[model samples]
Target: MFAVIRTGGKQYVVKPGDRIKVEKLEANVGDTIEISEVLLVNKEGEVKLGNPVVEGAKVVASVVDHAKGPKVIVFKKRAKKGYKRKKGHRQLITTIEIKEIL
Candidate 1:
């Protein structure tokens, strides 16, 4: 089965044994996290959706690792003004392995 869960203002569709990187969470490797903001779930082609979130539904996952995304560069310049600026950023993220859906 697969379920759609919301976290860090983003949604993810995940299934058992699937590993995905999500926004940073306050957990360490091997930590088990329960995500209760399940928006939808499909079991054997049987679909169920929630108005906002499905009550009594949750996705259990284990933290795999903490990671950082690729750096993104931002540059700004003004023509003939000799003004320029450059910046780079990397977003913190967490990798988790789906363990169960309940």
Candidate 2:
């Protein structure tokens, strides 16, 4: 079965045993997290969709690790004025392994 869940202001379609990286969450490795914001679920050719979220439906996942995305560089310059600016950023991320859908 597969389910659509929302996390970190994003939506992800995930199945059992799937590993996905999401925005940082307050959990450690091996910790179980329940994603209750299930938007949709499909099983055995049947589908269930919620108006906002499905009640009593949840996607269970285990924290795999904490990570950071690749750095993104921002550069700005003005011609002739000799003005320049450079910045870089990396987003914090968490990897979770889907354990079950309930």
Candidate 3:
């Protein structure tokens, strides 16, 4: 079965044994996390879509690791005024392995 879930302001479609990287969460590696914001679920040939989220539907996953995304550079330049600015940022991320969708 597959499920569509929301976490940290983003939506992801995942299935059992799937590993996905999402925005940073509080749990540490090896911890089990329950995602209750399930938007849709497909089991066999049956599909269920929620009006936002499905009731009593959840996805169970385990935290596999924590890391950061690649750095993004931001550069701004002005015309003949000779003004320039540069910045770099990397977003914190967490990888989780989907165990089940219920």
Candidate 4:
């Protein structure tokens, strides 16, 4: 089965055995987390969509590792004015493996 879950202000469609990277969560590596904000579920060829979220529906996943995404550089410049600013950022991320949709 596959499910759509929301976490950290984002939504993800996931299925068992699928690995995905999401915003960092307050849990250790290998910890199992249940995401209850399931928006939709598809089992076999049957699809069920929720009104925002489905009651009693959940997605289970295990944290595989903690990681940092690649750095993103932001540069700003003003024409004819020697004004420039540069910044870099790396997002904290968690890699999780989907285990089930319930």
Index of the highest-lDDT prediction: 3
In model 3, residue pairs whose N, Cα or C atoms come closer than 3 Å (at least 3 residues apart or on different chains), thus clashing, are none
lDDT of 2 by residue, 15-70 (tens): 99999999999998999999999999998789999899988899999999999999
- The digit string of per-residue lDDT tens for model 4 on 1-102 reads 788899989999899999999999999998999999999999998989999899899888999999999999999999999999999999999999999899
Arranged by lDDT, best first: 3, 2, 1, 4
For candidate 1, report its TM-score. Answer: 0.94
Structural similarity to truth (TM-score) of each candidate:
0.94, 0.92, 0.96, 0.95
Write candidate 1's Cα lDDT for 1-102 as tens digits. 899999999999999999999999999899999999999999899988999998889999999999999999999999999999999999999999999999
The regions of model 2 sitting more than 4 angstroms off are none
Better structure of 1 and 4 per TM-score: 4
Give the TM-score comparing model 4 with the true structure, all chains together: 0.95
Q: List model 3 lDDT by residue over 1-102, tens digit each.
A: 899999999999999999999999999899999999999999997999999999999999999999999999999999999999999999999999999999
How far out, in Å, is residue 28 in model 3? 1.2
Which candidate, 1 or 4, has the higher lDDT? Answer: 1
lDDT of candidate 4 at residue 57, scale 0 to 100: 93
